[model samples]
Target chain A: MRAVDARVRALESILVEKGYVDPAALDEIIETYQHRVGPRNGAHVVARAWTDPAYAERLAADATAAVAELGYGGRGGEHLAAVFNSAREHHLVVCTLCSCYPWPVLGLPPVWYKSPAYRSRAVLEPRAVLAEFGTVLDDDVAVRVHDSTSELRYLVVPQRPAGTDDWPADALAAIVSRDSMIGTRLVSV
Target chain B: MFDEPWQASAFALAVALQDRGVLDRRDFAVALGGELESGHDYWDAWLAALEQLLAEHGLTNPGSLDERTAAWRRAAAATPHGSPVTLDADPQRLRHP
Candidate 1:
């Protein structure tokens, strides 16, 4: 376990002992995210979109409903939106106010997403942030930044890589990194 | 993503409290805002919000909180790295104290 995790646990134990927290309810929520939900849910959506043009259209039209069609919808992602990436355009997601992430799809927000530098820089210098993640987009591709909130969040539908047209949905999903879905990185072969 | 069980626990506990109406979400956000503005880390801000809410509800006082946090830190310091930092052998005493 991480050092920070230990400190957090110590604090939680104290809070529970003081009757400020309910241990069972806390455990239920933790176990749900830790074991049941994660990025795989997002990957499945991406893979389906990559394989089915109709589904992709539906996803673009209504992300929350489309995602729920695949049986993945819950708290932290009630209102969802999907932005498709193409040769001419790229999409990136950020939460400038706070760490408002699509938890059902992305699991928990990463440490960097919650950092002050990332929150501010993602809006001011998205290209630089993407570069640090090794995603070098061409000058021709226009980058669109989407700001997430407690009510609305975004998911990036990355362009399908070359040589994967015949690949199955599962194969495509295997290459979809969590960062790719977040638009900070690309899905590579 | 959370690195361990407690990190998620800490996060979930805050959410649960708000859902239970123990504290208002907006109020917690206001407290968290102060931490963020003060340049604290995200989880640190979360911890601060939790502490602030507990105090506001009269669940725990600042003195006891400080003492408990210091004790926890000392216990963690003495433990080997990567090992579980258990507090006092009798947790019940600490619980009631």
Candidate 2:
């Protein structure tokens, strides 16, 4: 693992030397990640929710307990909660101060989630950010922004896509990307 | 050293930020070198240094590191799980819905 990390770092340095990323931009990116993405524990929880509605309700109400029930709770998932997104009310989440996430299930957060563009703009302009991810909210749909804080963490439980009705829970999991779990994009059918 | 793509992408963001002039190259390089030596992941070390710099330079008020850290924590907590990524409530009955 360490060797791979070093190689990757070396490669990144090479890219920077080659003028791929400016010096300052690199700092911002670093700031975004260490401070943004949390754990991947959220993924298992999400998968469970999709397969079991009863569990989904439990997760939505009390994330920590719900996760513990599934025996997949730890790290950033110490305190967890689920937020549901639907056609009427679209929800987007961001950590305006930093990147706090349900890592036990979701793995790591995407780079954009940690960027100043994402952190600062997510609260100020959620619709725009979602649009960048190709999520177009209807005018009638109200966009709600949830800011993740230290005391309470949030997860978006997106509604299952239309054509995916026939897919079993395991098959459905394949199409669920981290971005979709973050509420930035919906599962592509 | 992140084994995941998101981890690598996070490093990419730092590089991109340096390229964009949001951070000073010399200071960042110094911090990165120190972090690599201490076995800290690239991003972890950079954030620690940034936090320190912010405090040392009075960019943020003293004794507010906790607040800043908490804010970052919140962002990470807000990610969604499951398919289609909708933001509603949890699926469990353990907590108040």
Candidate 3:
């Protein structure tokens, strides 16, 4: 990794020096993904949905437009779809073909999400995979795995946990984990 | 899609190059395909494609790329896992420090 880092940095420096690339722009882009843009965007969306039933209805009807309404859209998230997780059903998202994740909402896909084992098993034995993430569901709860393709991506809106009905959207957003949005885990109050 | 900082950098550099018209996407795709057929790791193929594109574009030479690769190898070897890796500007310090 160090070797690769050194080589990449060298290439970057050369490109920047030659006017082929802008170092500041590069830094800004990296900073955007590293800090500014990420799962927090999805949290806000989820929080809004929990607080506003009308917005939730709109999100369910057109995830792309609703998410864009919140100002989140870009590569890997051009076509966004939201799937609600209820007590009787659990939702999970995976990219069997490749790591076709929704970057605008979920940030970059994790290493496991890109691994062959995860891509295959996420659809094959979702229960077992969820169990590994410490999310064992009720036997009666149906596990619905959504596969993300290059054209469309899925975001799982976990059912609001019990005892948080009065909580504000900001407070609700605080407890929504990336895994919960991915459906590997559930949100808790 | 990337696991490490270097991977992200490599990816970004490629995109930057293509965006700047320094590297042609169609040519890059062909090179990438060839690299993939060569059976190297994914990023390795990416690096190979980038290097080849740079050569075709007269941006940098293989010798310089090799020198930088060696310098980075030393830096990586010296740095501990989970620690940030920094490359020294001076080649001598990069080799010995």
Candidate 4:
């Protein structure tokens, strides 16, 4: 059998020739995912929400639009919804069918996300899954699992840690993690 | 671990196709359904499924995809060690770019 790389490259070339895909655009996207975009973009959005109530409101109202407003343009930013992890509710995201993710914000989906166990268990037992990630929430806080499918991806806005009201947005962003935005890990300090 | 360059490229290609609305969720699902249950070579399965989808959409056929891949392999084998491998003068296309 031919190497998968060769096959993929061939398919890409064919697609490019047919005009279904543009080689330049595809290369740009590959370059972006390779070295440009990742979890940091998501952290910036989280930090902005934490620092500015107005921005947070905008994010809450329409996450995709809010993210674009922040000037993040790339793949997988088209459909997004910010699920705020407040005192009353906590959000966890998983792509049950496949590893759909917010590429513009959170970058690529982690390996475990594409696995069968994590995908099934995340929705079935979110609390247990969170505990496995070293995040054990109180019983009062509700667990809302978001099935982050291809069309509509989700971003978990973890609640602002206490006593950081005076911190700058950049400083706050430093503590916002990729898993925290995915709701697998909680942000502290 | 989609850490390799080709791995990222393959994954990105699918996402890019879907983003352009050329490939939908149902198309992705039908193509990738079988591999979703397996434990091996997820990316290979993904590429195969993409090829199938492209064929179904009349973009390109499986035979052409295979032939082009073989051509690339031959080109790489024939090229020098220090330079790039390009499908320059194949009989299928009159001019090489």
Candidate 5:
């Protein structure tokens, strides 16, 4: 372990000694959040919104409560704000302050989301950012950028694909890519 | 991240502190933002922010972070190679809540 690593280890040992945290419970927490928290939690929310107008209304009104109803709660999901996409406008999520992401809903943020390049450019040129992700929107549509903070994080709900009218909510969720929820990619087929 | 053992340890330490209300989430974000503005490496800043709050909250004692860190350096050097390093207060731990 390097110096910083050693320091961190010392810190953890100290914290454990102080009884502030239990080693077993910390292991469980790490197990719960490592890599991706399935990333499907947000997909379920999106699919439910698409198939049920009433649920969608509740989501738009109280993003946090709606997410908790689905049994997910933590940092980013605690004070969430969902932004729904539409024919006239688009929404993209970024955190200029830091890599504050909706971890409970979308799992750990992708590496690019934490990169300074994406942080600066996403707000400066969202359309270009989206295009770089291979999502080309119509010229007349407006692109909206949502910056995340510790107090509130935003999730983009991409419009349901055109041919998915007959698809079940589970099927719709299966097609909801992580990037779509992050607003970097649009769902298709 | 798995490639670096400390990365996960650093992350876990921060989470545990925050979970116990020893570190404030909003305050932590502000510290991170400041570190980023100063051009520190992302992970360095994350570690620094946690260290900052840890020190402020007296988890390692306010002015003793440097001392404790240096102590670890000594401990690691004294421990035989291929064996896990143990602090002077090893296993017994140093405090009671």
Candidate 6:
């Protein structure tokens, strides 16, 4: 195993040396994939939850099963779970150990999700981080921080914003940004 | 630096997959050594190589891969840190009503 790992590393070095990738460009691609895909998936899931109470129940009970029901259970979605956010209690998600995410549901996790600042500070001072993201919880609201591990991943289901009453599920989904699902931002009115 | 962007992506994917323990390091090293024009092409090629490796090693048998990935997902879902917040149970539950 060690020998194999070494070889893989060496080959990667060669690829870098050969100029196949600019370390920076690769970073950008990964970032784009994360941003574009993550929020879209979150919006879809949020829309489904809003339109179908039964689906929301299933998602809360078992995310993976519920997602599979939608035919979105492949690739990074093998292990999916949802943490529904309500008015009284708020939930925030962070990956402290590594960037373990529900890629199937949210595509890729944003770079900030995996940063040391996010991982460390999210658990230690979640309110501050959320504040930075422009999410302000009332003093009475208790903030709960969830740390994602390699095996378990999480997505926040934001409380349905007001004035979205007549909108169709698809329309409602448009406002469910990735940041909102991460507990960093709230769904706009 | 290489002309093709895919090659670089391929290299990045290889490293990412290896880091994630999705592919065997030995095979990745062997396949990568064979050569390509640029880093951009690396990701596409690496994925093809990985799929081939999976088939060659008989790792593609009868939903086994899906089952393994499912297990990984289950493990991730079972994590206790994140749970749904119920309005009634939460002391801070928003009382807009």
Each prediction's TM-score versus the true structure? 0.80, 0.56, 0.73, 0.88, 0.89, 0.59
Model 4 residue B10 CA deviation (Å) reads 1.9
All models, RMSD in angstroms: 4.1, 19.0, 5.8, 2.9, 3.2, 20.7
Q: TM-score of the A chain in candidate 6?
A: 0.81
- Interface RMSD for each of the candidates: 3.6, 17.0, 4.2, 2.6, 1.9, 16.4
lDDT of 3 by residue, A26-75 (tens): 77667767777789999999999999999999999999999999999865
For the second chain of model 6, what is the TM-score against the true structure's chain B?
A: 0.37
Q: Please name the candidate that would achieve the greatest DockQ relative to the true structure.
A: 5
Ten residues in sequence with the least summed lDDT for candidate 5 chain A: A29-38
Determine the iRMS, in angstroms, of model 5: 1.9
Q: Where does model 6 exceed 4 Å of error?
A: A1-37, B1-97
What DockQ would candidate 3 receive versus the native complex?
0.31
Tens digit per residue, CA lDDT, model 6, A8-71:
3334433344453355655755554544445676788888998889999999999988877766
Instruction: Give DockQ: model 6.
Output: 0.03
How does candidate 6 fare on TM-score? 0.59
Task: Identify the superior model by lDDT, candidate 3 or candidate 5.
Answer: 5
- Candidate 6 chain B least-lDDT 10 residues: B84-93
What C-alpha lDDT do the candidate models reach, one value each?
0.82, 0.60, 0.81, 0.81, 0.82, 0.63
- The per-candidate TM-score of the B chain, in the order shown, comes to 0.67, 0.46, 0.74, 0.75, 0.77, 0.37
lDDT of 5 by residue, B47-83 (tens): 8888777667666674456556666776777777888
In model 1, what lDDT does residue A170 have? 97
Which structure is stronger by TM-score: 4 or 5?
Answer: 5
DockQ-better candidate, 2 vs 4: 4
lDDT of 4 by residue, A86-182 (tens): 8999999998876778988987777887778897899888998999999999999989999876678999999899989999999999999999999
Return whichever of 2 and 5 wins on lDDT.
5
* Runs with alpha carbons beyond 4 Å of true place in candidate 5: B1-3, B61-63, B70-84, B88-97
What interface RMSD does candidate 3 have?
A: 4.2
Per-residue error for A169 in candidate 1, Å, reads: 1.0
Segments of candidate 1 deviating more than 4 angstroms: A1-21, B3-6, B21-33, B54-97
